[model samples]
Target: MTDTAVIELVEHAPAIGRPLPDAVGRALAASRIVDAAPDPYTAGQWVLRAGSKVGAVTLNVPDCAPVTVRIVPKVPIARLFFLLGYSLDSRGWRDEQVEVAEHRDLLPALAQAAERQIDRALRQGLLQGYRDAEETSLVVRGRIREAEQIRRHFGATLPVEIAYDEFTTDIPENRILRATVERLLRLPGVARDVRRRLLHQRARLADITPLVPGQALPEWHPTRLNSRYHQALHLARVVLTDSSPEHAAGALRIDGFLFNMNKLFEDFVTTALCEAYRGTDHSCRLQDPHHLDEARTIRMKPDFVLYGPDRCPHAVVDAKYKKEKPDGYPDADLYQMLAYCTALGLPEGHLVYAKGNAPHTAHQVRHAGTIIHQHALDLDQAPDGLLGEIRSLAHVIAADPPV
Candidate 1:
């Protein structure tokens, strides 16, 4: 293998086709950054990140510059790393099972967020251990062979299969979590302290098998009080099952993970708004379901619905990943917001979009005293600023009437 195959080019927050990393390998084997063709010998596509996102970029033959390689994520996808961290942190770090020294120096991005999460989860899982080491029947060197030997014993090797209970970290869930942590441990860029913690965690979980993808997510509960485990279980579930951390490369098996910006935007908005409305008259919901007719042939699902004290929709809101066009707002979005307001018999609806140069505007429908308001949130802003917008939006929604 060549240097290009062995070493992946590191790109830091570059725009698509704007800032290109040095071209090292032959045409297509250079860097993973996506760009225009005949330009440089780089990977087929670029690892373009607008915010804190990490994923594999899939490409067509046309997108390839005669030879394009794939990039991979060692742990979970880049998207979840920060959000998970923020979620855990927002709860006053109550989710932490073990004391993790803050990593102020580490890039608060993809690798750090994931390593911190996995390291803590694995450590906590070990401290509390599985609910029950469920008696596993195994053939090993032991004191006694409880079950009858199925085959004739070889010279001094009569260890028959026997069922026994033990407190071991070598379980399926631990194995999966262990493998993910080990993968991050092997990555070259992990910080010194973070890497130290991960190495220790890997040693702790050394006995667990490195399970492959598609294994069942084992069940776990927080039976112990001193150590919190729901967080650990959540972290394990994320690395094991989230959509962004998927493999697009087959034989080469390079990490090609992707986070859908549209979905991420919607989820973030819904979550922030939900958090703000806690202990209020309105309860925020995401993807609330609805039936269109008596037979239920048609279904209407809105992104966020503000349910009032009566448990009926007081107002409805939709999140859009794109900006308002310089010419006008998207007609389809307006129609959809109107339908939600009418269905719920509310006078107001809202459309939230990524911040653009356009000023915020509101549209008054022709009849039924219905109106739709539009607001734009800057995605690049700090999390507090973005959540502040959601808080403001929640206040507006609360002032609306139901039916």
Candidate 2:
């Protein structure tokens, strides 16, 4: 009882407080995590379920040490669309085409196409009625009404007579008549007087929304809109329900509209890059495939190839509209630029991403005494900041001794 000594040993898991790996975090940030939960005892570790896929992450924590922890992201197919240019808005499928294909989910794209087809059919029906009236002078007559008429027969014989009349047959005249007659009948206007009863009847049959004056039919119209909508919907349904390449191609055309968003982004970046590097003795060449003599084939089309001061290869940059860096290292991008560098005999290249809040990164991989540098340009930053970063890069290139 006099001398009692106790030594307590505390064992703790590795610093579970450490943030998740960069790749996992990026994927999670871009995706929708379905079920994210952690054990109370092992708060650092988490089991995450995301869109038909599941994954786990164990944070690294030191013995009994409190450290900042970042949740790991789950990998799932749903994240694919976020990686692409599609985004969510209040409207149902704001950028449906891009979002569907970005996720590589053909079903939604096909469904959208099918819906478009239905709309197309409706539009076509409307326009066809107009065309029929114009071409054949076939006015649509509403239900004829029968009125009792007295006729002289053996006595006063009662006969049923119907009222009907004809009007001008020109397409424009018919269109006006139809529109006015329909409008008047709907509102019971003075234009529906008995004097013009027959004309009104004819107009009612041919009534349609008149085409705007001097305005040619729009690519999208009442008829075309409904018809194309339905056609697109049908085609989409066929595509989604089938695995045939034909169906896939049709779905891909719908997907093309999505890439248009990226095209717009690319154009903006291209313009920015051009403006920043103006007066630098650089020429911007687009889609010029550099031939790799050894490979005996066209290597790639660098989006923009800038010839620097003294006619040196200044920079080779390719614009990517992806929301997140794929595979963390931008390897695909690096590889693409490397091919350009090798074919152009340049020492370095640049990979410009449309989004990022961080400062630009310069990566150099030495090969045969030539340093192939891959630089990242974050276009989301202020224009001046971006311009400054670009200018700094230009200076760096100028100072580096050609390897």
Predictions in order: lDDT: 0.55, 0.39
Assess every candidate by TM-score.
Answer: 0.65, 0.34
Query: Which structure among the candidates has the greatest lDDT?
Result: 1
lDDT of 2: 0.39
Write model 1 residue lDDT over 306-335, tens digit each, in one string. Answer: 888889888888988664443565577888
- Give the per-residue lDDT of model 2 (tens digit) for 259-364: 1224434544555456556676665665666776777665667787777556666666676654334446656666666777778777766665544412356566
Q: Which regions of candidate 1 deviate over 4 angstroms?
A: 5-84, 87-90, 93-108, 117-125, 130-166, 171-173, 183-200, 222-238, 248-252, 324-330, 357-359, 379-383
Winning model by TM-score? 1
Residue 132 shift from truth in candidate 2, angstroms: 26
lDDT of 1 at 107: 27
